[model samples]
Target: MTLSCFDLGERMLSVAEAQRHLAGLVGEPLAIEACPLAELSGRVLAEAVHSPIDVPQNTNAAMDGIALAWPQPVAALALVGRVLAGGRFDRPLAAGEAVTITTGAPLPKGADTVIMQEQLAFPGAGQVQVSRPETVRRGQHVRRAGEDVARGSLALAAGTRLGAAQLGLLASLGLTGARVHRRPRVAIFSSGDEVTAPGAPLSAAGIYDANRYSLRGLLQALGCRVIDLGILPDDRETIIGALRQAAQDADMVITSGGVSVGQADWIKAALAEVGELGFWRIAMRPGRPLACGWLGEGRTPFFGLPGNPVAVMVTFLQFVQPVLRRLMGQPEWQPRRLTALAAEPLASRVGRVDYLRGTYHSDREGRLWVRPTGRQGSGILTSMVLADCLIEVDADRQGVAEGEPVTLQLLNDFS
Candidate 1:
C-alpha cells in the first residue's frame, strides 16, 4: 500500500498522509470511566469484557414438548408431571416415562432428548404417545449448557463501540456498568465575515454558514461533546486568541473558511503565532486546501476546512472523522467501504483522489449499482443532501467506466 509522507512542509499532501498523522496524534486514549449500561451507547470500551457464567446456565428445553430418554423402552410413556420455564422436574425420568416441558425448562435428570409438542399425541390417562418412534432424535430441541457463551470467555474486546446490539449483549451478561472512554470535547467555529448564520438577515454578498452546523452534527454522531465557539472575523489577533482559549478548553478545535493559500492570511498568521501548521493543502478535490494545525503550548490538534459547504463535508469525512474516532478511543474503528457497479461513466483525474456524491441501490437481481448526483460542484450542498454514498476513484486511476466495479464509502456507517 502507498503511504504519504506527512513531513512534507508546505507541499500538498495525500489523504493517507493526513489520516496517518492525525490517527497517531493521541498516544493513549482519554481517561476510562464506568458508565451505566443504559448510557453506554456510542462509547468505546477501554478493556475487554468477559462472561462470568455460561449464557444458558443449564441444559434446558428449546421447545415446548415432552422430555424423555433418547430411547423408549415401551410403545407409550407415562406423563408424570409438567415443567415450565424457570421450573424443573422433581424426579429423574424412568424407563418409558416422560414429562411435559415448556420452552427453556430444564430437562429432568436421565432425560437426554425432547420431542416437540407437534410431533406427539396425548392418548389421555396420563400418557403422551410417540406415534413415530423413529422421529425422536437424541438431544433434539435441547439447548446444551454454555451453548451461546462459555463461562469466563472474552465477550467484547477493547475499542469496541457500544451500540444497540452491544448494549443488549452486556445486559445479557447481567452487567450494570461498562468501562469506556470519556467522550472527547471538540471546539468548533466558522470564520470569514462574509459568512452569515442561518435565520439571520443576509447581506447581498453574504452566504449562510452551513459548515458549523453540519460539522456539529457529524461530531455528535461520533459521540463527541461539541463546544460551539461561534464565528470569528478576518482579524488575526482575535483568531489567535480564540484558538488558544479553545485549545485550553477543548481536546480538539476545528474551523472552516480559512487557511487556504493566498487567502485567509490572518488565519495562517494566527496559526503561526499560536502554534504550528502541519500542512495547508492536500492533493484532493473539493478540499485541496485542508489545514492540519496545532494550537497553544499544549499542542492541541486543529483542522481548518474549506469555505465551500461540500468541501467542508468531504474533508471532514476523509480527514477529520478518523481522528475523531481515534480521539474517542475507538482504535478498531475504520471507514466503511463497499464496491458497486457504476451505472454511468464517472470522470476523474490522476494524482488526486475523487469522491463523487452518489446514490446506491441494489437491483432486483441483487446487483448493487451507483449513479452520481447531478452537478458535482464544491458549493453544491444539494448534491450531498441527495446522495447516500461517495463513489471513490483512486488517484492512480483516471476514471470509472459504465458497468465497471467502483469503490464507495458510505455516508453513514453507524446510526
Candidate 2:
C-alpha cells in the first residue's frame, strides 16, 4: 500500500512503528560471495556450517604434568617416556609407570589421570614421586574428543556476522573461507545549491558539504561499498537524473539536504515523479522530516535525510544503519540502548521523541550518568562530536530532572 505524503501529516509514526515498517520492507539477502577467512570480519554468513571434524579431534592432555594409571599402590612410579605436544608414547603405560606430558599432547594409552608437575616430586631420572596419591582422580585433567565442538553439530547459523570469535570457530572446523552476503552498494550524495564541496572556494552563503562525507563514513563502517555521487544542485531535473542513475547502479540511495517540505526542496517532487515515495513527519527531534521509498525500476531503497549535519547523522544511525544490515542478511540487529541517570535537567515536549546529545561518564561506584553537551540544536555539529551517546527522552514523558533515570542509545564506547 502507498502512503501519500499529504495524508501523513497527522498520521506520523512513532520510532518503534517506523522501525517495524522499515524492517518489513527489507527483502532477501544480497547474492553470496565466497570470502577468505581473513577477510570475513563484519560479513554475514550466508549458510549454516556444521563441523566436519571434532575441534580437539582426539583425546589430548590439558596440563603439563605426569599422566598416571591412577589408584597408585605406591608413592613412586618409574618414568617411562616424555610426551610433547605433537608426540605420544610408542606403547601404552604398564602399572607403576608414568609419562611426563606437556599440555596439548595426546593422552598416553592406559593413563587415566594427570597429576600436575608441581604436585609431583622429581627426585631423579626415570623416577617420579607423588606425595599424595589420594589427590589423583580418574579422568581428571583430560580433554576428551569432541568436547569443545562435536563432529556433526551446527557451528554457526546463517545470517551470523563474522567477528573474531566466529572466524576462529570456523577455522577450528578446518574451514579456510566462508560464503557471505556481498556488501550492499550504497549511493550517497548531498543536494543543495548552498552546499559546496571541500577544497573549493565557497560563496558567502555557501557551506562545505559535510553530510555526504559523514554518511559515507557511517556506510563504510557498516561494510557498504559507497558510491559517491557528489553534490547536486536544487534543480528538479538535475536532481531527478542523478537519483535515477543512482537507483539503477546501487542497491540503496541516500541523500541529505533536500527532503524537507520547503519551496527550495525539489527532491521530494523528484521522488514523487520517479517512484512510490512517502515523506514522513516523524515524532522525533533533531530529525523530523524524512522521505523513504523505492526509486527506479530496480526499486532501490531511497532515504532522503534532513539538511542539518547532526540530523543527518542521527537519522542515519537510527534508520539507515539497521536497514543496510538487514539487507546484508543480518537478522534483527538492534542498537543497544541502556539506562543512565541524568546529571542535569533536560527539556522536552510531551509528544516528541527527543535525542539529546550528551557526554556520559561512570561514577566512582560504577554508576552511569549522562549530561547534555551544550546546546541541543540540530545545526551544532560539535555537539555530536563531543558526545558519546544520545539521551532518549520518550514521547510519553514531558521532561527529565536531575538524578532521574533516562534511556541512552550508545554512540560509541561509552555506552
Error in Å for residue 138 of model 2: 4.5
CA lDDT of 162 in candidate 2? 81
lDDT against true structure, model 1 = 0.85
Q: Please give the range of 10 consecutive residues that has the lowest summed lDDT in model 2.
A: 1-10
For residues 1-415, write the lDDT of model 1, one tens digit per residue: 0114335767767777667667766557778998999899989999999999888888999999899997887878999999899888888888989899999999999898989888888878898888787877788999998888789999998888889988988988899989999999999999988888889999999988999999998889889999998888888889989988998999889998877765655676788788777655677887888776678887787888888889999999988887777777775577789999999999999988888999999999999999999999999999999999999888888888899999999997753
Residue 200, candidate 2: alpha-carbon lDDT:
92
Q: List the residue pairs that clash in candidate 1.
A: none
Regions more than 4 Å wrong, model 2: 1-10, 132-140, 412-415
CA lDDT of every candidate: 0.85, 0.87
Minimum summed lDDT over a 10-residue window in model 1 is located at 1-10
Q: What TM-score does model 1 achieve against the real structure?
A: 0.95
